[model samples]
Target: MARTSVRQLHVTVLVLMLGALSGCTSITKHIGASPSPSVTEQIGVDMHYHQVLDTLGPPTRISALPDGFAFEYESFRIDERQLGLSPNVKFLRWFKLAYGTARVARETYTLVFDSNGLVKAFGNAREDQDAGKGLAFQFIVTVTQVVDTRYLDEWPGQHAWGVSMLQPLPVALNREQSLDSGEHGIEQRGTPTSSGQRTLEWR
Candidate 1:
């Protein structure tokens, strides 16, 4: 009876250890400055370029236009979730599996200035309808999910316990990627022209 109790305790300890080996982690990262509603309200068309700069701080990117230059202010909020599985046993200790997904929310404000340094056009773009579809962001998530699924079923031996054995992995169905997906949160339309004045388009 004492031997049976010892065996049961060992099993319980092993189960708890295995459970601890697998864990889920969440992380959040904020990039660039997010414009407050009050500050953004102060921006308007025909405002001096310097006014916008002074009001909203520096922009994330700048591009030269035919008539003038353009300033792009962007902010990103990224939330990432990952699940990691590792074997405590010595034989499979080297094996590790990790699956992760990142959701990126972006806000973009653009200011187009004329040669006179006056704002010709201004607009704001927010990632609402189209979020988590970015090339770089989605690519990483897809690779992790696919690899996680495939590796799980391809475990060695006649048992066959890798990704193939699992009918479906726990991946988010909403995560989608496309070749034509706009990498930029704010897209620019048409090419620069040598006309009287050029303006930027926001979609």
Candidate 2:
């Protein structure tokens, strides 16, 4: 019985060592991206819905709107690397803590379609950011901001084929645009008011 117990202990240690080795290696996870830039440029108002499906495959989410439908396609990639003491160097474990670095890249494409099955408007947004947690902060620092922009067929007070689509307040594209329009302050927090306008909040 003693010999069997010793063998089991050895097996457990070996398994743990292998796991540590694997963690030390960089790992990457990704989702779909096929048609590439061409598909992005091709998406425009009045484009056929079938063409969208053929170029980008099925959307990740779809919602039914009163006049038509909304389709959203999203793809993201995560890259991670483990640092600090690993089981391969068990002696260092007593002095060093495990930490890691990670990067996330995301892309979202949205298309709004009318009841006729033709695209009414489209938007594409992309983001890349770095993140780190735990004791790693002592050695690594990262700062990032997440921003999303949407382009619609119409702007404020604009109507499309008798349908009025609510538009968010215009966001200046550059210093020049801001100067020309003057500063338009937007509330970043608090529940939406009865006016039906939504605020932008960063996480």
Candidate 3:
């Protein structure tokens, strides 16, 4: 009897460890899928163009504007589960041998830059929906729920340079434009026009 009891104890411990590993796996996948530095950390009106590139790698799209340039970045993740019910409902259904429909969640992020290569704005959005398999056509519902969406703006100040911070600005022979240039190279297609005006475009 003692031998049998020891075997049972080992089985119980193994089950517990497997359960913990499953949870950790889920958390790890979520963290690994997220974008590093995130939009919030990199969005700043006075931030330089090179700094943005170094932090976020490269944008998904780049556009030349009459004023300066625009950079767009996008990222998304999708999670799918075999149950469309709450945790409590799913647990109860498990005992009854009743199968549940599938549910899916999707999250998205978008960032945009202005003419001077400074961040113009950024947004994060999430959506949740349900999916149905064959023979479960009745359960197939076209229900799309927007979980959340947030937007932030970071336009350059009219005189951001005038407000000095005691330390002298960095100097380079090619840096002809004022701080309004956002420290971007003049080689970019959209250099400031002769009138010193900049333009912006969004889609």
Candidate 4:
């Protein structure tokens, strides 16, 4: 009986230690709503400004133009994940590893109105970035893991769970144009482009 009791105690202690050493969490934050793609379909040149507002809700910003005024809609999103390894003991806090990654996405829509309160031109732009990666020893903090830096190239493979092997393209070109202005513009780029209105997506 004594031998059986000793084994049970060892198993329980091991389980507790394992739980304390493996602590991880994920967080996602979104600010503002993505512009509706269908809104472009519903809107047209000479459309009343109030009609555009009624279809798209409210604008993020408004600017006065020499011809009239402009309405701008914007959206932003953030994705973060963290992994922590350390003993539960307070004294062992310094013996910990923190790893994490953060991603950012943004988009914008612009409408130029004539003095008659009618839509004269419209355009859209979007951007997405890996932001970066983070790694630290002996601390309770969030990590931003960016693999492009190659700083952690030599890091141990055991931490594979916290590492992202894929690297985003060095640069992407985003072009925004007014449906009527017939102008060429270049902005930042991230993922593939789709037809109609643009929206943000996480991989």
Whose lDDT is greatest here?
Answer: 4
For candidate 3, the 10 contiguous residues with the lowest summed lDDT are 23-32
Could you tell me which residue pairs clash in candidate 2? none
Question: Which candidate model has the greater TM-score, 2 or 3?
Answer: 2
Would you list the C-alpha lDDT of every candidate in the order shown? 0.54, 0.51, 0.40, 0.58
State the local distance difference test value for candidate 3.
0.40
Model 4 per-residue lDDT tens digits across residues 90-115 = 67754567667877777778888898
Cα lDDT tens digits for candidate 1, 1-203? 99999999999998967754454556565665768777989988899988888898877656666678787776666666666565666644444455566665667788888989999898887773212221122221222331222211222221332333342322112112110122212233211322212221111
lDDT of 4 at 131: 57
Candidates 1 and 3 compared by TM-score, better number: 1
As for TM-score, the candidate ahead, 3 or 4, is 4
Ranking by TM-score: 1, 4, 2, 3
Question: Per-candidate TM vs. native?
Answer: 0.54, 0.49, 0.33, 0.53
Native RMSD of candidate 2 (Å) = 13.6
Candidate 2 ranges beyond 4 A from true positions: 1-24, 86-96, 135-203
List CA RMSD, all candidates.
15.8, 13.6, 18.3, 12.7
Location of the lowest summed lDDT over 10 successive residues in candidate 4: 171-180
